[model samples]
Target: MSGSLRKGLYVLSFGGIAALLVLVLWRRELYLPLSLLMIGLVMLPFFIRFERRRLRAEELLLVAMLGAIAAVSRVPFAALPSVQPVSFVVIMAALVFGAETGFLVGSIAAVASNLMLGQGPWTPWQMFSWGMIGFTAGLLRHTRFMASRWGRAAFGFGWGFLFGWIMNLWSLLGFYDRLSWPAFASVYAASFYFDLAHALSNVFFLTLFSGIWLNILGRVKQKYGLLENGRAG
Candidate 1:
């Protein structure tokens, strides 16, 4: 990507996040959907960049397969509060696949899973939240922090709650009339244990399965000659 494009994307991604916070804080309820749509539209350029770089048929299929695994990975954890392997898997894909692939895998997984679990207004939020996690990981893959195992675990832990809190906003907007500190705190408090479960589970999977998955996917990438980015390795 061009330097200008990269900078613009960063602005759009985190700028949209900042806007989301503003909407909640100021009770600009009507603008929430529009903000989300704008964010999605801004991200289209990144996807377009990937396509322009010549994403091949097999590579797209690879992303779809990974997304399918991520979507179905939640089934076994249905009995749990928030423990699931979806985020862990998505992070791994980003670690090996770069930002664009990670974004698609994360977004597609949310949509695919929700289609089976039942969709609602929250679907887009789920997609955006999870997609951001993958994008952030991919963005930082070349850094020393992401190169370390403990760092990856820490990131997974943080993203688990981030994902939950972002998802909580959808519920907040869908059910509550206005955003207040008490309401926000109450919502977060109620979901605290579930978020912790998710965080711990993500850390566990990152610590245990990251190496295994990375090794396997590394082999696959080498065999298939996928993802030409230097950061992916």
Candidate 2:
């Protein structure tokens, strides 16, 4: 099969399995954690292989820096609300190195950060949400949607809305019985405002930064080409 076609099919298959596990088996505690572990496992080979083939000190440093920033941004010492700029960084990585790198950054950064904060059931959801966003952004990189400023803006907005919606849905499902239905519904209704804010903020930040980020990534790619077989060199 052609490389692009093969990659496309692989991504679709993984996504299908992930969705089924989330929708059908997420209620079972074992299933949730196991599913998350499986996700990490499924992506691990790709990450390792990519790393071996395209190991660049500068890129590694950048990835580490981005992950550290994301982790520190969520420090619970203060009551300040944290904004995740990791998604923007993930998009840049994906555009530069490709889909596998993007997914690796998103999944590893999220899981590591959450573990540092506290390992809970919520960790899996956060991993899934962030990983999925980066994965999708990477897939979109192959399309014209990420090739220009307007395209990147639209892609960022759509993904932002999707990320907020999915996070809210997961929160509701995970906390359904614990929260009184009336109160939950009221809170849920009001949550639209929060979601809107998140989406708008993501759109604004991505629009403003994507151009410069992409240019930086282009330079990185030119200086150190990515692994041909998706492995780190």
Candidate 3:
């Protein structure tokens, strides 16, 4: 296929996957497998492009290092279900790097760690949630919101809850096939305290350490001159 035609096919495939994801929002079982496939599909083009650039090898190295940090950070917090610094690390990675880097790091962190943690249907959702969080941070890095300390704290606070909420979907889907607001609310309520801990931990960490992390990452990026064209795309 011509390059343009090949690109069009990818676009169509992504769109189709997106539309199906929407359609299966209430169908728990179908949602898991489809969402899993969707993540893989999204990753396909990203790695394809990675092969095109020698520069990307350096970028990939940085992403791997950051991703390893994110994944390993989860180990220390095993005593607690929700409170972890992985989110903070991923967010800072995005803030310093860019969306693509954030996305890759977040996604890889999930998949790679799951290999050690033991993968299951929930793996994809974990990947998607963390990946999106990182992507959003990177996307907003230049905006005034990300530029302010208060804003970064707010972002951290929000993503902490956001992470838990997405994980709740796993319980909702895997446990209950027939969805209802009451059941959903029950699941959410059960997870509330854990989520709050995660959120507060994020707020505290961002309040105290975001500046330091950003400065360190900034030095790394500048020393390496990474992601020169904004995002990888």
The order by descending lDDT is 1, 3, 2
lDDT of 2 by residue, 81-108 (tens): 3345656676677666666667667766
Segments in model 3 whose C-alpha atoms lie over 4 Å from true places:
1-14, 22-32, 42-56, 230-233
Poorest 10 consecutive residues by lDDT, candidate 1: 30-39
Model 2: how far residue 132 lies from native, Å? 2.0
For model 1, residues 67-149, the per-residue Cα lDDT tens digits are 99999998778788789999998999999888777887888889999888888777778888888888899889889998889
Q: Which lDDT tens digits does candidate 3 get at residues 53-100?
A: 456577778889999999998887878887888788888998887876
lDDT, candidates in the order shown? 0.82, 0.63, 0.80
Clashes of each: 0, 13, 0
| 93 Cα displacement, candidate 2 (Å) | 1.5
Q: What is the TM-score of each candidate against the true structure?
A: 0.87, 0.70, 0.85
